[model samples]
Target: MRTYALTVFSQTGEKLLDESFEAPSNEEAKKIGQARLDETGYSEYTHRCVSPEAKLVLFHR
Candidate 1:
Protein backbone atom coordinates (compact mmCIF):
# COMPACT_ATOMS: atom_id res chain seq x y z
CA MET A 1 0.00 0.00 0.00
CA ARG A 2 1.02 3.59 -0.59
CA THR A 3 0.65 6.48 1.79
CA TYR A 4 -1.52 9.38 0.72
CA ALA A 5 -2.12 12.77 2.26
CA LEU A 6 -5.51 14.45 2.06
CA THR A 7 -5.70 18.11 2.90
CA VAL A 8 -8.57 20.56 2.95
CA PHE A 9 -8.15 24.31 3.03
CA SER A 10 -10.38 27.29 3.42
CA GLN A 11 -10.67 30.07 0.85
CA THR A 12 -8.32 32.19 2.90
CA GLY A 13 -5.70 29.40 2.85
CA GLU A 14 -6.37 28.28 6.37
CA LYS A 15 -5.71 24.63 6.98
CA LEU A 16 -8.89 22.79 7.72
CA LEU A 17 -7.99 19.16 7.44
CA ASP A 18 -4.76 17.28 7.06
CA GLU A 19 -5.00 13.54 7.15
CA SER A 20 -3.07 10.51 5.99
CA PHE A 21 -4.41 7.28 4.62
CA GLU A 22 -3.16 4.23 2.79
CA ALA A 23 -4.34 2.88 -0.53
CA PRO A 24 -3.06 0.43 -3.07
CA SER A 25 -3.17 2.93 -5.94
CA ASN A 26 -3.66 6.58 -6.72
CA GLU A 27 -7.12 5.92 -8.10
CA GLU A 28 -8.21 4.33 -4.87
CA ALA A 29 -6.65 7.15 -2.92
CA LYS A 30 -8.76 9.62 -4.85
CA LYS A 31 -11.98 7.80 -4.00
CA ILE A 32 -11.05 7.52 -0.35
CA GLY A 33 -10.08 11.13 -0.19
CA GLN A 34 -13.33 12.25 -1.76
CA ALA A 35 -15.32 10.11 0.62
CA ARG A 36 -13.54 11.61 3.58
CA LEU A 37 -14.18 15.06 2.24
CA ASP A 38 -17.87 14.36 1.81
CA GLU A 39 -18.16 12.88 5.29
CA THR A 40 -16.52 15.96 6.71
CA GLY A 41 -18.72 18.24 4.61
CA TYR A 42 -15.69 19.63 2.85
CA SER A 43 -16.37 18.20 -0.60
CA GLU A 44 -16.77 21.62 -2.17
CA TYR A 45 -13.85 23.16 -0.35
CA THR A 46 -10.33 23.62 -1.63
CA HIS A 47 -8.60 20.33 -1.21
CA ARG A 48 -5.95 18.00 -2.53
CA CYS A 49 -4.93 14.41 -2.17
CA VAL A 50 -1.31 13.59 -2.87
CA SER A 51 0.64 10.39 -3.04
CA PRO A 52 3.84 9.71 -1.12
CA GLU A 53 5.81 10.83 -4.13
CA ALA A 54 3.95 14.14 -4.17
CA LYS A 55 1.86 13.33 -7.20
CA LEU A 56 -1.61 14.83 -7.01
CA VAL A 57 -4.28 12.18 -7.00
CA LEU A 58 -7.15 14.59 -6.53
CA PHE A 59 -7.50 18.35 -6.38
CA HIS A 60 -10.17 21.05 -6.24
CA ARG A 61 -9.92 24.78 -6.06
Candidate 2:
Protein backbone atom coordinates (compact mmCIF):
# COMPACT_ATOMS: atom_id res chain seq x y z
CA MET A 1 0.00 0.00 0.00
CA ARG A 2 1.00 3.58 -0.63
CA THR A 3 -0.18 6.93 0.62
CA TYR A 4 -1.64 9.25 -1.99
CA ALA A 5 -2.55 12.92 -1.84
CA LEU A 6 -5.87 13.72 -3.48
CA THR A 7 -7.46 16.91 -4.71
CA VAL A 8 -10.86 17.30 -6.29
CA PHE A 9 -11.97 20.37 -8.20
CA SER A 10 -15.42 21.42 -9.32
CA GLN A 11 -16.31 22.01 -12.95
CA THR A 12 -15.75 25.74 -12.71
CA GLY A 13 -12.27 25.31 -11.15
CA GLU A 14 -13.31 25.45 -7.50
CA LYS A 15 -11.59 23.08 -5.15
CA LEU A 16 -14.11 20.94 -3.36
CA LEU A 17 -11.91 18.51 -1.44
CA ASP A 18 -8.36 17.69 -0.50
CA GLU A 19 -7.24 14.58 1.37
CA SER A 20 -4.54 11.98 1.87
CA PHE A 21 -5.04 8.28 2.26
CA GLU A 22 -3.57 4.87 1.57
CA ALA A 23 -4.47 2.79 -1.43
CA PRO A 24 -2.96 -0.16 -3.25
CA SER A 25 -2.71 1.61 -6.60
CA ASN A 26 -3.54 4.77 -8.51
CA GLU A 27 -6.58 3.15 -10.07
CA GLU A 28 -7.99 2.24 -6.69
CA ALA A 29 -7.21 5.69 -5.38
CA LYS A 30 -9.22 7.26 -8.19
CA LYS A 31 -12.14 4.97 -7.53
CA ILE A 32 -12.12 5.99 -3.89
CA GLY A 33 -11.97 9.66 -4.85
CA GLN A 34 -14.91 9.33 -7.18
CA ALA A 35 -16.93 7.45 -4.57
CA ARG A 36 -16.12 10.16 -2.06
CA LEU A 37 -17.35 12.84 -4.43
CA ASP A 38 -20.57 10.96 -5.03
CA GLU A 39 -21.11 10.45 -1.32
CA THR A 40 -20.40 14.11 -0.66
CA GLY A 41 -22.91 15.29 -3.31
CA TYR A 42 -20.41 16.58 -5.85
CA SER A 43 -21.48 15.47 -9.30
CA GLU A 44 -18.94 17.10 -11.57
CA TYR A 45 -15.28 17.39 -10.76
CA THR A 46 -11.71 16.68 -11.83
CA HIS A 47 -9.15 14.98 -9.64
CA ARG A 48 -5.41 14.72 -9.33
CA CYS A 49 -3.17 12.34 -7.43
CA VAL A 50 0.14 13.17 -5.85
CA SER A 51 2.85 11.21 -4.17
CA PRO A 52 4.05 11.80 -0.62
CA GLU A 53 7.27 13.32 -1.94
CA ALA A 54 5.34 15.97 -3.90
CA LYS A 55 5.49 14.27 -7.27
CA LEU A 56 2.50 14.32 -9.60
CA VAL A 57 0.94 10.89 -9.94
CA LEU A 58 -1.27 10.16 -12.89
CA PHE A 59 -4.75 8.71 -12.57
CA HIS A 60 -6.66 7.10 -15.43
CA ARG A 61 -9.54 9.22 -16.71
Pairs of colliding residues, candidate 2: none
Error of 1 at 31 (Å): 0.7
Residue-level error in angstroms, candidate 1, position 42: 0.3
Total clashing pairs in model 1: 0
- On lDDT, the candidate that comes out on top is 1
For model 1, how does the per-residue alpha-carbon lDDT over 1-61 read when each residue is reduced to its tens digit? 9999999999999999999999999999999999999999999999999999999999999
| TM-scores of all candidate predictions against the true structure | 0.97, 0.58
Give the poorly placed runs of model 2, Cα more than 4 Å off. 10-14, 51-61
For candidate 2, the 10 contiguous residues with the lowest summed lDDT are 52-61
- Write candidate 2's Cα lDDT for 1-61 as tens digits: 9898877776677877788888887778767766766787653557677776666664422
Task: For model 1, state the Cα shift of residue 55 in Å.
Answer: 0.5
